[model samples]
Target: MDLKKVERVYTSYAGVYDQIFGKVFHEGRESAIRNLNVQPNERVLEVGVGTGLALPMYPRHCRIVGIDLSEGMLAKAKERSEALRLTHVELQRMDAGAMNFPDDTFDTVVAAYVVTAVPDYRKVVNEMIRVCRPGGRIVMLNHFRNGNKLIAAVEKVISPLTKHLGWRTDLSLSTVLEGTTLHVARKQQVNPLRFWALVECVNAKNGYVVLNGAAASYANGNGAAGYAHGNAGGHYASEHSV
Candidate 1:
């Protein structure tokens, strides 16, 4: 997944991206924000905020900084922000692998449909963790390699072909979290056929559990406070289990 190619592919899709992905991925976007559970006046950063489809869904009280590498996509996002009169939103064209923000700059960091699209998913994830404050939330909404062996094989075969469309199909959740201080507090399967995943992690570099509400208060029996499987009412997965 070359960065230049990804940019070109999204630039071409910018005009119709909302129509193609808006409704299909709407539920996952909404779920990801809900998992974020942002507080008033918190600083939030969104990577790969293509077309800003999730813009209007965020609470207006929190400050939002949305970034993407594709200029064409950012243009559409700008239009959406203006039309919605979202004064709290800010849009910038920036690389996900190399964000300009300083460490611990944001209260929450989100990346929807972003993990598999970048050239180096690990680099992007590391950058996300670097910018987000310790104990803050880092929400990811995207498809991971299926757990079923048969499906995983099929995805591996199709991954090369999908790269041209600006995403890969064979990335695993464990692979994305490798070597990171992020702890998977919750993960839920969303979208049609449950093809996509909505994962919420705590930036646990400081060893603090900071997620709020019932989701955070519910004990997982392992002493953790979040659910591992949102649909099954499962216990929370350990830090590396996601």
Candidate 2:
């Protein structure tokens, strides 16, 4: 994808983007944050942190660094951070495939709806894990290829159009993790589109497990194991096995 074109598209939509797509893409934001399990005062990094939607949900005392490729998105994110008084969160305009951070620099790293957007998904994931502490978590909320054959067929049909519309319809969450050290700790389906999924995993560990079934349901204020909708801003809380 052309970097300039991507920047232009997002920049053009930055102001009204949330209003138009928030309900659709922001559903799992809170869940992704909770699953991160960041401790107070820990260093955290969020990739593709559009408009800083997750900023308000971070542990209040933690230091957060957010990176995105779109300067237009960062401008809105900066306004949001300032408005919410999120003094600890910093925003930077950077590409996900190429990060400027050092190795093992953060306690936790997060990527929300970012995998599909980047041309090189694996490279970005490797970078995310590289910068995270050995035992740290890499929490993600994204759209993937559902194992259902019928759904996969439909996704294939619309993939070209979806891609043209600024969405990647073919990046399977499971496929992307292949040959990597990231281990799946939990997973849940979030939408019928068979695209949105919530996944919690640790970097380079054995005894990996893939959750096979429906999305989880939970009561209010529960934790990481609950039902979450969309991608970023909404999620039901519940306890999860990590």
Candidate 3:
């Protein structure tokens, strides 16, 4: 996908984004931050924080740094942050595939509706892992390819058309996580017809040796791991739900 075209599409949508998509993806956004389980004083990073829709949902006890590629989107997010008086929040214009933060910078990293929207999804995932501390949480909310053969076939056919609208529908969850150090602990289908996925992973960089008990449990195949299908409120086994 062309980066310029992608930026242009989202920049143009900045004004009407909340009006059009705010309610449609509200459940998934709320579920992602709620399940984030952020701790007091912990540092958090939000990738592609478009319009800061999830900004108000986050607890103010922790510090949050939000970044996006579109200046228009960031402008709206800044307005939201100011309107809500979220003193702990910071906004920046940056590319998701090449973040400017150093290694192990944040306690949790969230990417909602971001994977398929980028030019190189794997590169962005790696960047997420790079900036996240060991055993930290990497939460992603997006729509992956349908598991059903018939549905997957249809998505592939219309993927080109969808890409023009700023995102592709043919990306699979596995493809996004493959070769990355993200150890997924939970993958749930959430909200709006159960068409989107909320994947919670543990940043197991270096190896499983860096993981804590919760993350290690997943790597050892001893934890309860399953694909959940339902609304955002749907419960699933988790490693970071403290």
Candidate 4:
């Protein structure tokens, strides 16, 4: 959340990020993009595209633009784009909280493993929603605070050190959705431990529509296993992947 601190932290991480996070979080990034089911010629926006890890996975037909606040991260992303010949992807260094695009610009907006890193998570969400079309989709792949008291307590103790890593370990899904128009249409557990979540939703004009019993504990497999239930008319309750 601290811009200056994040800049300092990732300034030197661009070169080694792949070695550290590539394999561990690879599934999370792949699953998030796959869930998008992008159609040809669709306009897509990726927020906080650290080192452009997902750029190659994106469909070549789609007009994809990735934005991040960290120039350290964007520099590597640019190189990746060039190396891989990802002509459809564009990298830009910009604050997610204050996006420059107009309303209803992108058909699908995705944020991969970056919700808690921004100075204003809420503002970033709003911007993502604002740029997304009315019937578009907004997907997020992120880690949240564990519901276990012991795990949460430990996270709190080390929360101060998160600034150095450029992300927080105690963020909650509810905290990220404090005042957003999007909702969790589907939630899939990514990563081996299922610590990371792949959330997919539509850009509804109404308020958020999270599935029933959507909570950190629910995702952690302590309470109930993930399941999706439908309501009258149209609504889907939250559930984990198979």
> Could you say which candidate leads in lDDT?
1
Where in model 2 is the C-alpha error above 4 Å?
A: 191-195, 205-242
How well is each residue in 211-242 modelled by candidate 1, as lDDT tens digits?
33333333221323332223233232224332
Residues 1-242, model 2: lDDT tens digits: 55676677778778988898777765588667765555556777899888887789888867899999888889999999999989898889998888899887776688888887776788899899888755456778888875788988888788877765566776787688998877665677664463588887655433323233443333211222223232333222222333
Candidate numbers, best lDDT first, in rank order: 1, 3, 4, 2
- What is the RMSD of candidate 1? 5.8
My TM-score estimates for the predictions, one after another, are: 0.87, 0.81, 0.87, 0.83
Stretches > 4 Å off in candidate 1: 206-242
Give the Å error, residue 42, model 1: 0.9
lDDT of candidate 4 over 32-109, digit per residue (tens): 887566666778899988899889998897789999877888899999999999989888888888889998788778
Model 2, position 107, has a per-residue lDDT of: 61
**Candidate 4 error regions (>4 Å):** 206-242
| Model 2 weakest lDDT span, ten residues long | 219-228
TM-score pick, better of 2 and 4: 4
Cα-based lDDT for every prediction: 0.82, 0.72, 0.81, 0.75
**Across residues 23-106, which tens digit of lDDT does each residue of candidate 3 receive?**
999999998887766666778899999999999998897889999999899999999999999999999999988989998888
TM-score of 3: 0.87
How does model 1 score by TM-score? 0.87
